[model samples]
Target chain A: MGDPQLSGEQVRQRALLRFDRVERAVHWLNASLFLILVLTGAALYFTPLIALVGRRRLIEQVHLYVGLALPLPLLLGLAGSWGRGLRRDVGRINRWTEADMRWLRGLVDNAAGRRPSAPRPRLGKFNAGQKLNAAFVAGGGLVMLGTGALLRWYVPFPLSWRAGATFVHNWLAFMFVVVILGHIALALSDREALRSMLGGRISSAWAARHAPAWLEEASDQ
Target chain B: MTEHAGPADELPVRGAGAEQPVPSPAGDGTQEPWSKPIGRRTVLSVLGLGALGTLFGSHLQSGISSALNAVHANGIASLLPGGGQFTIYTVTSGYPAAPADYTLRVGGLVQRPLSLPLAELQALPATRLTRNFQCVTGWEVADVHWVGVRLVDLAAHAGVNPAATAFQFRSFDGIYTESLTIQQAHQTGAIVAYSMLGAPVTREHGGPVRLYVPSMFGYKSIKWLSAIDLVARPQPGYWEQNGYPIDAWISGHPPVQAA
Candidate 1:
């Protein structure tokens, strides 16, 4: 894939699959649902929205249905070729490496938009921060599913059980909002990264700059 | 449970089994309001509720509260607007018809097995209260006014057996049942209510008579009142059997279900 004579434009012209079709579809679907959930959930949680949000019952019904269906897109993605690939990605996220730790160490400067004069580390398809966010979302989503279900169904759970589940659900919602906002901000900061999610591909040079190690892996595949 | 207690603690607990046919104040520190015949006031309240609930149908809760606020002037019932429609979570759909061949059996571990008709209950001292009914799902119906005889009144009427410490409220629908500890029964706002926001409790709302424990979630308030069986230990309700918390609090995480 490497040619010493190739120009920068030639390198930028080659598009490699950064995110597969199934991955892009599921990711975007989940993103849209997450945004709606945040908006509706916020309206329900805060009191001012009661008067501001018309058709309160209708919105509530929509929130419940949308929340319950949040996992469907991922489930559908798994039914295709993504079942194994998704598991592999989860495993990849769970695994730790020196490069990941190094990326995390530099995350502070990265967040502040400061490109240090020192050499930066090469990363895989996902960096330490992205991996952490993914794991957090996955873990938080499961907790939400469990707690939300318990709250909805009147199974005679003790007040304490209900309270504990409720407490977790509430705090997790705040964290969910914060993390999702950060994710959106980071995505918007990188035009290529955001476009990759929508188009399922990124320019070869763009991949090399952001995820050099993963670019090599992709070329090998 | 958190220290945030509801009105559940103040009022005297009602028990079935008063030796006297008429409700006399029990001497055991429970001073109850005197019983009166269902007067024109009660009928007017029902009519007023019907006007509020039906006239402004979509705005039943808000309208009802506003209507009641005009008469009572108590600001508690008029504070927050009702959020959404009340969702009925029932194992089965069918409920027994009311005031037609209806009788509430106050038996099981009582001195007298009395089959009191609806009129007999209406004759008992009716206490009117407005409460914030919070569901476990975080939805709330504020200023919900209910009128009913106290559980202590019923227990005193039945002369509840001294040996029994708990009462399992059984619903006529057969699908639902719940047990309240003697301690819970003693709390304030524990009553077998028959009226909601002035009107008779609808079949959908657990009618004829239903157990209301303000401290606990709505499910603990057994609808379709049938029988109250007193026992040494609490038998888990239908939902309790289905893995719900036995000691469900509006604010606390109860320990695991007893083995």
Candidate 2:
């Protein structure tokens, strides 16, 4: 069990394996590829959006390569996980609760600089913020895969449907970038969080504060 | 919860027993250890590598374009005809059929509405040309040989009313609609293509008929072509309604020119 007191030294006591080696590898691979796709795809989407990236031909070539390369990491990750990793996360996000709602409200109030009367609720494996991130990543990945396939092929959907697909693909990419930035910022802001990602283990105190329920389950296991 | 100036500025301390062996800074700052400075050598190396990358990437792109153009000049010897590759990804719906029983109707603000069948339309003086097919999403297939009646010829035959300023093209899919200025519709290279690559247009390529506007982006070339309605004013196309540029012009790089 993690020490409950908030202190710099106590941070080291929390320890658990949230993501296995395979999971971490898949995550980083996807992140790197996604970043590349966003960069090249954005260049292709709005040519003048970034001038230094290059001319139309170069940007296009890079975009195509990135697009083509995307499926590789995605397929490999999927094959390795057998779809279980994504399924578990999806299920986790779908089971929202009253505690989750309270946490979200506290987060908003905290953001707005309002001192709420209630103490911050203890989170389980994932807080509302993390749950939301998981949901978007899963949902966004599926949409990206589907639309990219359609666009690559000459298959003509009704113009409206094609347009709709394009809309989802472009906007979702933008939103994903924003969310990923926030995730990275949080990881960097919390030393324990980054350590968990890097070492595949979190301090016992971190597990208790951020995910007490997860810590208990892992201890039992 | 303890009060703080702002969430971002709050010092993030680990719960008891969670802290690792890493030394804590004297100040109560939330900044994580990851923000620590990298060596000057590393920084300089990263900058130098970035510059090198940009230079090589641009040169490589230029080389590719030249090679492509060279192949185009050699004609039959080229891997991609017209110096550009053609990728035909299959659409789920079957290709559109031609000598299509469908009628090409011109109505709305036109002085006289006219409907012509595939045969009668084909009989009219046909215009054929080879131009690049450029998609807004960023692929270009050059020298895409297309054969069909020029839009100008059709307008001439229909005897467009002087007041008609634009035309709306509608496809059988019913959802896709594209509008063009009278001038754009009558441009020298603009055609209502019925054939591609020296063959009758396939349904997958928006065959039966599709608009071919060389100067505009691919979206402007409405496929699965059906009707042309003359309009007194401009109307946005299907893609435009969904956030795509209305006048998607092809620029040298970054397909759509900066506004």
Candidate 3:
């Protein structure tokens, strides 16, 4: 569309940087670890899956280790001078402005097939939806880590606490599966967003349309 | 390059100026922790911290375990670790079987040594016990109906010598063995169980007979019952040799923490 003859390097030159290499690396690492955790967790939790994958002890160990490792990527990404992009992005995700509230309302209207009001607010590097997803991943990851650790090495706690942890961990895991599926569906529908996550770049034209506020800010800088 | 906020390369500029020194985000900077050169003192400190952490963890676990010993949170038994079904702990590749000419030996410190066939063992005065079959490692099958000859009746039939103070039980499996105090063996609830779950015990369950010590943990109820040797002193059997308690009583401590 924007000059078909453009080489990969030429396109990359014209593209806006959305995620840096460290951010993308962290994202992919987290995705891979989460996938392993989900598979191993399913094998451990479900009787049919347990029967299908008969090495229960091995699966249990893998689940424990993978779950423990889930937070490592984020922690590593948020560390050192190389983590500047991740740190800034995390800050952006935490702060909600008036434009974000407007974007959230627009999301509801967009879902209902109703056109947004005139002069709709421009979204930042991450839209309200993306910010909410990021918050959930961060908060939910911590909750899961605490509960899972308790379940794995529960000798330090009373039977009652262990039982509560089991309840929280199991239910939260199911919830995570549902939420992650929806996240994947949303990413898939937005080709540019998905591409940006993979290649660390998005077309200027795409950024202007989807994240005009972020594009304007970048231009101002 | 104008389309991007930072430089076109991988690293992004976050501060007011591209040349500005980047501050540490969360004190997780490489300059302090990861990038530091390893020294002997640092290594020793880390090792010492690790040892302290391990000791603290173990002490905390034991303290919690002791404090919660009386806390019978039985309502959530199924959710407890290894709480549900019976997990078979077999050492042999295949279950050992009693020969067609199998005779359970009732000897050693008895007035008269008697070797009786399965039919003869079954014909002895039977006692049916309905009790929870508790495993040492936090599991119990409740209200299991076990039909077999009482150990007291068997001891009476063989005329156990008054000098005898304990019984050493040997499994037909050859490798497996167990022992119980004579007083525990003479409990009304204990039996030489021949039938379980409304059927004759399967080989998986150590048939055609197994001891069911209802008052103690499942490990105390030795399987593949083949011989009973009366002795003067209580002897630790196979599991006891492997650090399992000699008296795995299901009381005072809960079934889940029986071990």
Candidate 4:
């Protein structure tokens, strides 16, 4: 298929097929289940505080079911996207450089709109923000899954295993939720970026502006 | 186009001007017709599943509580022909002391015996973990935070002797005891915890220090850990002597099931 045209500003041609159908499906599926996991996980995580309202059992049960069901969607998502660009995207996000520290410093100054003009780095398909999120979810997801299995099966482990798993599972859950919230906030703020995921394409101009390297790579392809 | 569009501008764009492609039927071609749209139906089904789960979960919790209560009340009378002993203490809560004051002593067999205080312990790098807290008494508490040095960190600090096979944990109570193969103590989540829930350990819970091993039942996690003694021979702990499972990990043995 030829490149799609864009109308609004007449500045950007829309890019296409960055994510294959299977990739998109996995992304959306993971997104949906992750939301559900967050809800159920949050309910479970805050039980000590929530128990004051007297729904500990209810919250806990929901937590267990959600925890049990989480692996299916997660595994499906991982299997679908394993060797695809998504994995590369995850890798890109996790690659830390000195510039990321500058980006973080810019973030603080930029909030008050007094940020200094630093040389903009050529971000690939994923930026530091995206990479960190991906790492947190992927790494945290694996830990949660392994510990969760031991928990549900409750056998084959020594007592120490059970207790330690419980502790890590909870801590990771809270960290994941915070990262997810940040991810959503960024998506909402960047309208074109959000549309790119929804439509599986980004305006060429938008891509060039935000991800010049990715734009060049896509154009070369 | 207006910079700030009102609700009228927010309406779904049906024609050529829409920003994103309308979801295609082929996108979901493999799904059954009934699964189409993922709208109200999916939402309801998810909610319905959650509700059903809640119902079953409550039943499980209640059943578990009743069984544990029976065991707690009657002192394992139903399981062991000879009744087991029960000790009930009032609930007390506070943070545990820092590792500086904490002393992890490993004495008993082999060469290179050691006792390091909290400062010496913290001087080495620390391993922090956060995980769920499940009580065998029938309450499942998730997300209990723990920060401390890992058991491996300690073992590395105090050099393990190859001849040492079993590690016995002695708690402050002087009553509770648990043992692990030297290899098992080196697992990823195994740690000697000085703090829980972001604070120091509390007395009610195992304070001063505790041995946290993730994967086994809570009882296997010895609380109020006073000392860790390595021995060449297997020594039965208080619980083991009392007929509790030496491992005590969750083996899916149904509560109160006939042995």
> What is the per-residue lDDT of model 1 for residues A60-119, given as tens digits with 9 covering 90 to 100?
567778889998887776555555455444444444444565676687777888875345
What class would a CAPRI assessor give candidate 1's docking?
incorrect
Off by over 4 Å in 2: A1-14, A49-94, B1-259
Can you write out model 4's per-residue Cα lDDT over A1-221, one digit (the tens) per residue? 12322223543645644565555766787777677766655544432333223243454456566666654643454344353454444333434433444466676678869846675544445555564555456545656665666566654555445545554554456567777788889889998777767777767777666655555556555
lDDT of 4: 0.54
lDDT of 2 at B87: 32
Q: Local distance difference test, per candidate?
A: 0.64, 0.60, 0.66, 0.54
Q: Each candidate's DockQ score against the native complex?
A: 0.01, 0.04, 0.06, 0.02
The better-scoring model by lDDT among 2 and 3 is 3
What TM-score does the first chain of candidate 1 have? 0.85
Off by over 4 Å in 1: A1-9, A54-58, A82-88, A108-119, B1-135, B138-213, B216-259
Q: Where in model 4 is the C-alpha error above 4 Å?
A: A1-11, A16-18, A45-83, A87-118, B1-134, B137-259
Q: Which candidate leads the pack in TM-score?
A: 3
Better of 1 and 2 by DockQ: 2
lDDT of 2 by residue, A1-221 (tens): 33343434644464677766655776787777777787767654442343334243455456656666765654564354464453343334444444566688988888999997466655556677786666456445555655665555423433333434444455456667778899999988998788766778777777767876456555545
The DockQ-based order of candidates, best leading, equals 3, 2, 4, 1
DockQ of 2: 0.04
Q: How well is each residue in A105-216 modelled by candidate 3, as lDDT tens digits? A: 8878899999986347655576767766665666567667766776566545544454445544654677789889999998999998899999998886776667665665
Q: What are the chain A TM-scores of the candidates, in order?
A: 0.85, 0.77, 0.90, 0.73
State in Å the error of residue B61, model 1: 30
| Ranking of all predicted structures according to TM-score, beginning with the best and ending with the worst | 3, 1, 2, 4
Q: Flag regions of model 3 displaced more than 4 Å.
A: A1-13, A109-119, B1-259
